[model samples]
Target: MSENTPLPIVEEDDWYRDHLATVDEHGKRVWIYPKKPKGKFTNYRTVVSVILLVILFGMPWIRVHGNPLFMFNILERKFILFGSYFPPQDFHLFVLAMIIMVIFIALFTVIYGRIFCGWICPQTIFMESVYRKIEYWIEGDSNAQRRLNNAPWTASKFIKKFSKQVIFFSIAVLVANTFLSYIIGTDQVLAIVKDPISKHTQGFLAMIAFSFAFYGVFAFLREQVCTTICPYGRLQGVLLDKNSVVITYDYLRGEPRGKIHKAVKGKEEEAAKMNALLGDCIDCKMCIQVCPTGIDIRNGTQLECVNCTACIDACDEVMTKVNRPTGLIRYDSEEGIRTGAKKIMTPRAIAYTSVLGVLVLLEIILFATRTQVEGLLLRTPGMLYQKTDDGYISNLYNYQFVNKTSDTLALEMELIGIDGRIKWVGHAPIAIPNDVTEGAVFVELPPSELQTGKNKITLRVRSGDRTVDQVKTSFLAP
Candidate 1:
């Protein structure tokens, strides 16, 4: 319900909580035609969206040290972040980084309610700044859109609707390709595009599916994603409190709302008395008209509120026209609106911040100290020590090396403490970028160095005279 809805005799204030603003009492969806929003906040959000979109589209193509700036190739168990290559061996680091990000978002939410959703969320940016703006350009403003929808299907209506869908799907396709590039690398995505569809059927189908999913989200789902599907929106009820800064209507300054009126020349005293009883708000419903999620700012904070600031701009514009001060709807905590005191550093916020800081630091340290190459040396499972013709004891072994660098690694291994020589069963492995190399080798030693059951052996692994890893494993002998 909005400002225009009639109040019920009982539970009038609680009615809005009973159902979503986009749902009717009969449980059907109420289509919203939000008025095109303008003002400083909208302009600012447009600029932010443009920058974010540029970064989102550009990141996959941007390379650092021969690696994509960011990649998470789960298919190959390879990940490259910034210029650093992380094989499956560094999965721990990736998990830690993810944890840090989650904690940071939670901390931000505790201090500023849903500001990320309004200003930085990809959903809000694409809906409000890209797709919705294009919709307004094609269908005109909210009134024109409503009228066109209500009117029977005409040639002009069909043309506008068709043109909008074509553009929306085209953009969705582009976004899907960009998203795939982040997962599989830009070169792979380009290969899929250049290759025959039959050759890359799975990749081609994945791209098309992703495109359709995105189109559905922007074209039809819209605000429902935020209201019902997003876990972050649901978390707001637990994360937010009276001290959290949000887009709030100043009930102290805007309550007892009445329509603006002019006084007659002789009845100025009566007009003044009437004005004294009213608040600054004129009940124009402009705030509701501009809200993307179809919420009334006058009803205080709700689950549907994204802190988009469209209502703020609309209310400010109305206030300016009516010769009243602006900020009827603006950024403020509930406590600030009631008591005029703003406090953002609550105990929950501090705790989350502290945990986030430690995680970030731990991630940094782990990344800095991580090994460039890792090796796993194991003795062959079924083989026992064999006697060589030259009076030497030989043990068969298997070795695996993980390369975490951009360059190829030609590994060489030698016995560290034992007097022995390594003979490759076939050839020693040459590790490639973000790949694992495995091989079998024989460690031959004199009988003096052999133990009765098992002997401790140390292997020093090197690449072109530079030590890579020192691995210790058990060598079996009879």
Candidate 2:
């Protein structure tokens, strides 16, 4: 290249791609102190957070048919959904539900970006709305917080910090207890609190561990949970595309950035000429100042962004003050910014939605068609056919019954397909109540109905007059 040739232009802001906004170049965490956000969007998010928090803390206590509305007792292998009981036998339904959830999240992310993280995620809700709000109340806003941290260790600072820590830890404990209730039931949690510590030592310790974990996450980890720890944040690179609607800086309308300046006393023509070259943005960094994750929205979308809309509120305020039309930073897609069009139903999103719909429908059908009881019958181990005096071939079998309802089941078993008589080894019928029942029975079939080696047989289990379950097993013969 000759001296006359122009040098290629390079983007300085592209450096943001190499490192997280919440981390310094040394790989150490950079604490964020976002200015207290105030705008219509912030208010809307507060309402939503309040509603979600209420639902979360209250769900364990909400009962239907004498059981929690929703409970996932993984320890006992019991799950209750909307008063429906599911034992280990219904694990397939649980698996299908998880698959459906994954597909739904993919579909939602492809079209709407990480709105879930910003609006409904429990982490963001507690950090921004709960803990952070409390901090702001105790220590004042961002500038005040910075000053307090940077100041010498005085009694005032110690008192303020101590009070904040106490409140933060208290909230963490409450959060831990609330979540524990979801897993173990509110009654169990209350029992652990009311009972002797020696009797519930493990549960008490678990609650303490969870409390400290929550405290550390909200107090220290903060934005790192979204930027570095959460897999959903990392997934943005793969899930998001030009068509996805996300919290975006309208670089097309706000670029060629320059500060807004008043005209000089006499050089009005020059000032007007310079103003013509500038865009709506006045180069004020209010967006960056209000960002929770500490990224500049003007740098374009990055993984650390949680779509919290704080930047949108801040930018809109700045724009309004500058007499410029608002929405310099707003919810939009790259394609929409470039072409002035938005398309949500892309092929990828449509495909994901289709798959999600099918799975959800299948889940509903399976849940509706699920039996009240599930039974499993197997031939007794190391036992063979016994020839009876009545010229019948007998096989000893062990049966396990899972009751999936609140009511006790008086179940009677009958042979199907093969002409056989079921004789209970211990009891005549099985009584299952809210748990599993194990028993033994002898299935006797005439030699005419027996096969040479293995014969397929079905057992119909009935509760009163309704068929609750049907189990199939093989009968071994001579």
Candidate 3:
């Protein structure tokens, strides 16, 4: 800790250090303006972005049994996943599903590192491919973008800047609508758009709020979301190990690094010096220039790196220009880079895989054991047992119907145990909502029907004029 002691190299570990732009001596949030990336990986990412964009935008309309395959209607407290309805009563199931998903993500991250952050995540897909591309399109590449920012707002600058904002805001609005569709369902989103002011006033307002936030995030907020905001990104240090494959610089091959051109003699000497002191790296700073998180990979693994492969592509291009073999930077573990170890299946990875297997089995078993039909019978409040003309004791009972089915059910309720006659107040079969429980009526009979002090009464509900659900209740008597 003394001034005489050299600062130790910052090692990446369980705790993530601040990878933000604005930070105090105590790690904190600061703004960052990342240089837009280009090269092979960026090209691959663009293709991937297009595919993801289609899937994201298309998901709302993709129907499962005429319902959205995915809808989390927080407002209605109704969740429909893959056409299976989950009401408030299924909250335990929802919690379990969430836990399973979180564990799956953790296991995947432990094995493969932050490939999700770079490749599959919506944040990265939108920011890197959509907004960043637009930024590059309007403001030019990194250096020109820097220059344009520094330059005053002339008519030319004003128009270009204005155009970018207009585009950004437009995209945000589209994104907001798509995002809201997932929460409120495609039908509600359509109602908002089609009916506008009259049908969905609150929903319309919510859409606007979401759009503005998305705009702010993609435009001004940018990389801070990954560096400072995202908890998943923060979890990477704990989830990832030395064996996890990450975007890494091969310092052994590329270090003691100097410009390859600078060390050149003529032809053979140029190649030899290029192979010697300079390694393969041209020191073009292209990798640094393209990084979205803006931390140098050559400085060793840092929390800021998203493993987007921008550096790999950039370095490969540099190698190509100098007629050298590529991969100065690649997806590799620190051990792999140092010891030339390939990405073999390790003990830690096997353990994660085993855990994942167990989780999958548990999920399957839990799903398989779940009941399809359920019922609830409640005694009508303030109603006592009544003696009928035929000496039959009648008890007024409220019956609830729960049908986890796609088809409309016509349930025939029957009271079983001892001698009893079941009659509905309405003489109609019990019917329920498509994905909800409906309450109706029933009356049970016979004084001798009560076998015990408090008899066990069973009410059976039939789906097709046959018994499907059976509910047990305590029959009360003096």
Candidate with top lDDT is 1
Tens-place lDDT digits, model 3, residues 178-268: 9999999888888898994867789999999999999999988777788768999888878888877888888888867776554434577
- Models 1 onward score TM values of 0.94, 0.95, 0.87
- For residues 1-478, write the lDDT of model 1, one tens digit per residue: 9979985654766677776889987789998899999999999999999999999998898888788999988897778989788887888998998898888888888899889999999999999999999999999999999999998999999999999999999999998999899899888889899999998999999999999999999999999999999999999998899999999999999989998656889998888899889999999999999999999879999989988999999999999998899999999999999999989899989999889888998998998888778988888888888989998888888888888888998889998877888898887778987778888989898888877888898989889989888889887777
Going through the candidates in the order shown, the clash numbers are: 0, 0, 1
In terms of lDDT, which candidate is stronger, 2 or 3?
2
Winner on lDDT between 1 and 3 is 1
Error of 2 at 131 (Å): 0.7
Relative to the true structure, candidate 1 reaches a TM of: 0.94
Task: Answer with 1 or 2, whichever has the higher TM-score.
Answer: 2
lDDT of each: 0.90, 0.89, 0.77
Predicted structure 2: clash tally: 0
Better of 1 and 2 by lDDT: 1
RMSD (CA, Å), each prediction: 3.5, 4.0, 4.1
Residue 296's lDDT within candidate 1 is: 89
Clashing pairs in 3: 22-30
Candidate 1 positional error at 107, Å: 0.6
